[model samples]
Target: EDQVTQSPEALRLQEGESSSLNCSYTVSGLRGLFWYRQDPGKGPEFLFTLYSAGEEKEKERLKATLTKKESFLHITAPKPEDSATYLCAVQATTNAGKSTFGDGTTLTVKP
Candidate 1:
């Protein structure tokens, strides 16, 4: 089964706190993995895409890394404005079903 799971469900951090979020997956035929950020009442904003293991990308204070079976998003000294829900999605080689998405991690940064 092609599936993705994110850990911690939710996280609360101080304005300067740093943390990491995890996304684990099991896919029958791998194609690509995606990450997105969604703010309340808004659609998701594309963050990064990973097509192979060991690929990594960064944007501002957020860094995303991928592995054969899991991915990680590391936050560096996050600020209150960084509070949002982080989501992960995966696609298989063939389109027999909709892209599977992780449950998402709701992060709240307090000032």
Candidate 2:
């Protein structure tokens, strides 16, 4: 069975503070790693898709990188408005679009 675990569970950051959220996983064969951001009462918004080791993607203040067994989501100089729940999910080779997801790391940035 594939499983994903996100670290810190929750984080509090001051405006302009940079931090990284972790997503660790174990799978038989990795198909892809996905990252998303979700606000309360809303569905997750797509952030990145990592397909191979060392692959990375970025958007605004967020950057996501993938490795053989884990992924990281880095927040750079975050603002209060950047606060959200960051979700990590992984798809295995035999599961097609099916994915095992982490509970997510909730981030709060205070001004």
Candidate 3:
């Protein structure tokens, strides 16, 4: 079975503070790992896709990294607008269209 776990269910950061969110997973065979940002009452927005260990992607103030067993979302000098729920998901080689998702980590960046 494929499984994902995100730490610090919720996070609070002051404007300009940088932090990293963790997503750990176990899968039969990794096909891909994904990261998303979701706002209240809205569907998640795609952030990054990583296909192999040591891979990484970046957008604006966010950076996503992948490892064999885990992934990280790094937020740099975040602003209030950066506050959102960050989700992690994984696709396994055995599951073509289905992905296992973590509950998500809600972030609050205050000015």
Candidate 4:
């Protein structure tokens, strides 16, 4: 079974405060890790695709890093507009099932 878990279901931060969220996973055969940002009532927007460990991707104030068993989303001095649900998904090599998503960590940046 491939499962993903995100920490701190909700986070509150000041406009310029930086923080990092964790995404942990357990799978029989790990194929890939995906990061996405989903705004209210909108579908998830792809952010990064990590194929192997020690790979990192960045865009603006957001950075994503992946490892063998987990991944991290580091927010650097986020603003109010950065507030949204950060989702993590994983594809397993063995099963042909759809990717499994984390419950998501909701971030709120106060201006």
How well is each residue in 1-111 modelled by candidate 1, as lDDT tens digits? 788999889999998889999999999876888999999999999999888999999999999999999999999999999999999999988874568999999999999
In terms of TM-score, the best-performing candidate is 3
The C-alpha stretches of model 4 lying farther than 4 A from their native spots are: none
Q: Candidate 4's residue-wise lDDT over 1-111, tens digit each?
A: 789999989999999999999999997878889999999999999999888889999999999998888999999999999999999999988865679999999999999
**Model 2, global lDDT:** 0.95
- Model 2 regions more than 4 Å off: none
Candidate 3 per-residue C-alpha lDDT over 10-86 given as tens digits, one digit per residue, 9 for 90 to 100: 99999999999999999999999999999999999998999999998999999999899999999999999999999
lDDT per residue for candidate 2 within 8-35, as digits (tens), equals 8999999999999999999889999999
List the global CA lDDT of all models: 0.93, 0.95, 0.96, 0.93
How does residue 51 of candidate 2 score in lDDT?
Answer: 95
What is candidate 3's CA lDDT for residue 41?
94
Alpha-carbon TM-score of each model against the true structure: 0.94, 0.98, 0.98, 0.95
Rank the models by TM-score, top first: 3, 2, 4, 1
Top-down lDDT ranking: 3, 2, 1, 4
- Ten-residue segment with the worst summed lDDT in candidate 4? 89-98
